[model samples]
Target: MAKQYTKNLIKREFLKLLEEENFNNITIAMLAERCEISRNTFYYHYEDIYMLVREILRDELEKVDEEFNETFSWEESLLHAVSFLLKNKKAAQNLFRSIDKKEIDSYLYKICESVMSRYVDNECQSKTIDAKEYDKRLVTDFYRAALVGLLDKWIQDGMKESPDKVIFRIGKLFDGNIERSLRISENLDEA
Candidate 1:
């Protein structure tokens, strides 16, 4: 219990610091000082700042996944995920600016892929598409990449636009697109 508490304390302080300064500017010593723990304690919980950030991203993904399962709406799930970054705008922007682009891109890809996969599955089931596994995968991948690109741009632009409006536009644009893609893939396979 105490161990978990210490870890959470470190995470909180780290995020607070991220909001104020760039991730590269933060150090283990600074985090330790803020948490009022020894340097070893920070090391005990995380190997380095990178690992800490990775864990936070993974946790956020898990929360988004859980919420996605409950709501079964891809738009809502996406909005929920983006809302985290929106809520922590400064921290998110700082982290994005300081961290390796690959790290953030990889995390965003995972989130987009997961949400898109679920959406494709639900759409296939509802539309009675009977899409082949390959077709479904292709459709999911296409949408996932598009979604990831959209999110990457939004973050790069400092998240100026409202997430609700962005998601609503995405929903409007994607309506029936999945079904069309599936049918087209099926037709290609038949041809």
Candidate 2:
């Protein structure tokens, strides 16, 4: 219990620092100082700042994953994910400008993939579209990449636009698109 408490303390302090400083500028010593723990204690919980960042991201991803269910519309699921980035805008921007940007990209991609996969499956079943397994995968991957790319561009642009507007636009584009894609795939499979 104490061990978990210490680790959470380190994580909390690290996030606070991340919001105020560039990722490259933060050091283990600084994190340790902020956490009021010894350098060895920081090392005891994480190998380095990068590992700490990764663990934080993984935890957030798990939370998002657990909260998502079949009942959530794709837009809602995406908004839920984007809300995290918007809430942590400073830390996200700091990380995006750092060498660890790939981690953020990976996190977004996984979330997009998960959301798209479930949406596509549900849509196919509801529409009674008999898409092949491979086609379903292709559809999921296509939408996942598109969603990730959109979010990447939004982040790169400093996330100035409201998430709701961005999600609404994507929702407009997505309206009937999934069903259309499945129909095309189904026809291709039959041909």
Candidate 3:
């Protein structure tokens, strides 16, 4: 439990540092100093700064699991997730704009893919979506690509609009019937 407590402290301080500094310039030594712990102590919990980021991101992403259930509207679930992401806007921006854009992009894509996969599988059971097992995977990947592209653009655009707005407009790609219907046209959030 002591290690868990320390890990939480480390995650919080890491996010604070991310909000204040760019990823390129922030170092583990700086983070440890900010947390009032030795560099060795920081390393004991995290391999490096990016490891801390991954842990923090996992925690953030996990918060919306309850929102993923059958009770909430898909848009509401999406809004809740995006709103949580936007809560630490600066931290998210710094992380996204880092040198390892690929890893971060992949993480975001995975999250979207998971959400879309569940949605498709659940809906297709009742014939709402026309997809076989193999095709479902492909379509989910394609949709994930769209979401990732849009999110990347939002990051590049300095998040000019709130993530909820972005999600809403993206949902519109399915013509606002995304809740009950699944159709693939085009989502221009990347454009």
**Which 10-residue window in model 2 sums to the lowest lDDT?**
182-191
Q: Number of the top candidate by lDDT?
A: 1
Question: What lDDT would each prediction earn against the true structure?
Answer: 0.84, 0.84, 0.70
Name model 3 segments beyond 4 Å from true.
64-67, 126-131, 176-191
Model 1: runs farther than 4 Å from truth? Answer: 70-72, 183-191
Report backbone clashes per prediction.
0, 0, 0
Residues 1-191 of candidate 3: C-alpha lDDT, one tens digit per residue = 98898898888887788799998889888888888889999889888877887777777667655457644444555556666567888887887888487777766775676577766676665546554456556666777788778777887888778777757666666753442334442321221
- Candidate 2, residues 52-155, lDDT tens digits: the string is 87888888888777887778788888888666788888988888778556776798898898788888888888778888888889889998898899888888
- How far residue 112's Cα lies from its native spot in candidate 3, in Å, is 0.8
Across 1-191, the per-residue lDDT of candidate 1 in tens digits comes to 99999988988898899989888889999989998999998998899988999988998888777777644567877877776788889999999998889988998998888788888887778778778888888888987888899899988998888777877787887687777888777667643
Ranking, lDDT, top scorer first: 1, 2, 3
List where candidate 2 sits over 4 angstroms from the true fold.
126-128
Q: Once model 2 is optimally superposed onto the true structure by TM-score, how far is the C-alpha of residue 38 displaced, in angstroms?
A: 1.0
